[model samples]
Target: MSKTVGVIGGGQLARMMIPAATNLGLTLRVLAEKEGEPAALAVTALGSHLDVEDVLRFAEGVDVVTFDHEHVPQAVLRELVARGVNVQPSPDALQFAQDKLLMRERLAELGVPVPDWARVVSSEQLARFLADHGGRAVLKTARGGYDGKGVRVVRDASDADDWFAAADGEALLVEELVEFRRELAQLVARRPSGELALWPVVESVQRDGVCAEVIAPAPHAAGKVADVAADIATTVAEALGVTGVLAVELFETTDDRLLVNELAMRPHNTGHWSIDGSTTSQFEQHLRAVLDLPLGATGCRDEWSVMVNVLGGPATGAVTDRYDLAFADQPTVKFHFYDKAPRPGRKIGHVTAGGDDLDLTVFSARAAAAFFDN
Candidate 1:
């Protein structure tokens, strides 16, 4: 009998995992709220991640349970665990990924470098945080923030009232804006058997608070920098007792120090390039880690590979037509669409291009993205 894997959430990440699970000879089942939610359309089941009965029923006979997102409530996860269902990146480890405040505190306690931050529950607390951090800071909700949502840049104390109102006047986090040279990401995979592997560092470009592009083996990054970042990621994964893929988003300060920005316990946008650019993609590694299978190689298959996100724009109706025209001109580019309805600023798909020359690869990726726009 083949082993079954139960995945929570039904986004592009889950959609991508389907191919990996199939290749591994594992059955993929998803708990989703509705139809057409990326993976739900492709997986073996459709259920609500929040529905205890639905999730419990969905996990029946599955060898292990994993996730595409960390939005599921801990109580629900704990309930599933109580019933003998195996949950990778267990609830204790996932809490840090789910809550920014909890992640910050844990990293601090582990002596990991992170931005100066304060947790604020009221206007008075916000005011004090501003005074201590030079009247400007980034405010984030403790939980449920992603892709530029639930995050804000506040320069005045008055902004606290709006933040509090936005979050229903609940507690929030205020963090100092560090002067950084560039953003970097380190991805690591940890198995239940205590094995781990690290991938090459990648440079991530953010536009309008959304990831725009990723360049693997980040240009001009020193060998030492990559080693340090990987070591830090490994340390954090072990310290937090995380099982499965863990992505550490880093801010390289002007003074050449790396500070943790965010933690993701799933296949991250930063590692998307590995799909066609590495010996083993992050999606495959994630599945292996969750299943406790031996991890594959993490080495890059080429000197340079670039991945560009295809954010939906005004010309929505022309996407299919654009894909036809774009691929006609650039047959080497690999495209993966999410089978999603297009919405402005939504991530509908991504393109990856690889070449011996970094400049050419980036140029090809950018041009392919532009071709889709036209």
Candidate 2:
């Protein structure tokens, strides 16, 4: 019998999973947030992921439950597990991703390399942390922050007064502002049965705190750096008891050291290039991992692959309207659209280009992605 996999959120991640599930002959069901959300077309049911009754109905008959996003409430997830549903990356491991303070505390216990950080419950506490960290620090809500939201760089306590006021006396997290040479991402997929697969460590380019591009097998990542990255990712996966794809976002310092910046237990934006540039896409590997199937090879298809996100631009128009131009200009570039309306800075699509030369591949992808900007 074909096993059914239920995804708890309807976003681009779930949308991308449709093709992989179809190819694997698996049934893919999504508990979409809205009637016509990005992954709605691929869903078997429609409802908010937060609704216990609705989620219970969606999980009925599904062999395993996964996620498109990590925002699902812990109460709802725990309820599902209590009901005997198979939830990969169980709530115990997921709480770290859901709450940064918990993540830092756990990583610290494991002796993981992380930046200086502290938990702050008041403006005075934040001021003390900032004083210890060069008088400037990054403050983040322990829960519910992404894409530059709920994060701020503050030079003094007054800078974060609003965040403190909004927290209703709840504690927030503060960390030293990292002075890194560049950002790196390591993606690892692990199965319930202890099988693991790893992809090359890649360089991620961020603009205004949002990832704009990724270069597979990061430039100049040769011996020790690559090995340490892989080791860190592997260790993190085993330590956290994470199943499915786990993305470890790291900061590669100028002095040649690595620091754990963040963690995402899902097919991440950094691995999006694997769709056409790897022997196996992260989406496919994620499914195989959750289902406890033998993993696929993680080799790159070309010497270099560059993925540039096609963020919504100033001019408003459908992504398809620029496809003809993009294809005609760069036939080798591969485009993946998420059936979303264009909005400034939103990720509506992406273009991946691979070849023997990194510069040319990057140029190709950027050109194709830029065509949509107008």
Candidate 3:
């Protein structure tokens, strides 16, 4: 008998899992937010993720429940757990991914390297933090932030006046500005039985705080740095009881040390290259981990694999319309579109290419992504 996995969000992540689930002989049922969403191709049930009734009803047919995004309400998750639902990365672990403050506190308890940070509840506290941090810091909402949203770089107390006034006593986080040389991401998959698998540490390039491209086996990541990254990911997964994929975003400083930047509990954009670059993609590994199946290998298929995100530009045509031009220019490039419409700066798709030559792989991936620009 085939097992069924229910995903809580109807986004590109869920859409990408459909092919992987089919190969693993598992059925994917997505709880989509609306009709015609990206994951509509799957067995979809429409409802608000926060609605307890809807979510519980959707859970009836699936063997286990997971998430495409970590936006589910904590109360609802606890209710699911109370009712005997098989929710992978149980509410206890998922809380760290949902609330940034909780994540920071827990990582610090585990001896994980993190940037200097403090919680600011009022404008006065914000002023003190800025003064101590060279008059500038990065402020973020403790919850509901992603893709550069709900984030601010402030130099003065007034810079956060809007947040302070509208925060309604909610705490905001302020961290010392990290002057990093580059950003890196480590992706790990863990099963309930303590089995763990790790992918190559990759370099992630961001534009406007959004991931623009990723290069697997990050260039020049020799012994110590890679080991530190993998160790950090392993520590987090084991300590937090994470039962699926955990993406640990890191900051490589000028001093050559790595610091934890963020945590994502589901398939992350940084691992999208694995679809074509690795022997087993993150999507497949996530399913296996959630179902308690043996994890797959995370080896890179080539010396270099580059993934470039295709962001919506000023163009108005469908992404598929550019397939001809992109294929003609780089036939070896692998393109994955999310069935989403064009909108400035939105992630509509991505292009991946792997080969022995790093420069050629990067160029081919970028060229294919650029073809969709207009």
Please give, for residues 167-216, the per-residue lDDT of candidate 1 as tens digits. Answer: 78567989997889999999999998999998999999998888999999
* Residue-by-residue lDDT tens digits, candidate 3, 183-293: 999999999999999998999999999999999989999698899999999999999999889999999999888999999999999999999999999999999999999
Cα displacement (Å) at residue 265, model 2: 0.8
User: What local lDDT score does residue 177 receive in model 2, on the 0 to 100 scale?
Assistant: 96
Which residues of candidate 3, in runs, are more than 4 Å off?
none
Candidate 1 error regions (>4 Å): 166-169, 313-318
lDDT string, candidate 2, 1-374, tens digits: 88788998999999999989999999899989787778877788888888999999999999899999899899999999999999998898899899999999999999889999999989899889988989999999998898788889999899988888899988899999999999999999999899999999999999999999999989999789899999999999999999999999999988889999999999999999999999999999999999889999999999999999988853756677777777899999898988888888898889899999998998999998899895
What total of clashing residue pairs does each candidate reach? 0, 0, 0
| Candidate 2 ranges beyond 4 A from true positions | none
Model 3 lDDT on a 0 to 1 scale: 0.93
Clash pairs for candidate 2? none
TM-score: the better of candidates 1 and 3: 3
Which candidate, 1 or 2, would have the higher TM-score against the true structure? Answer: 2
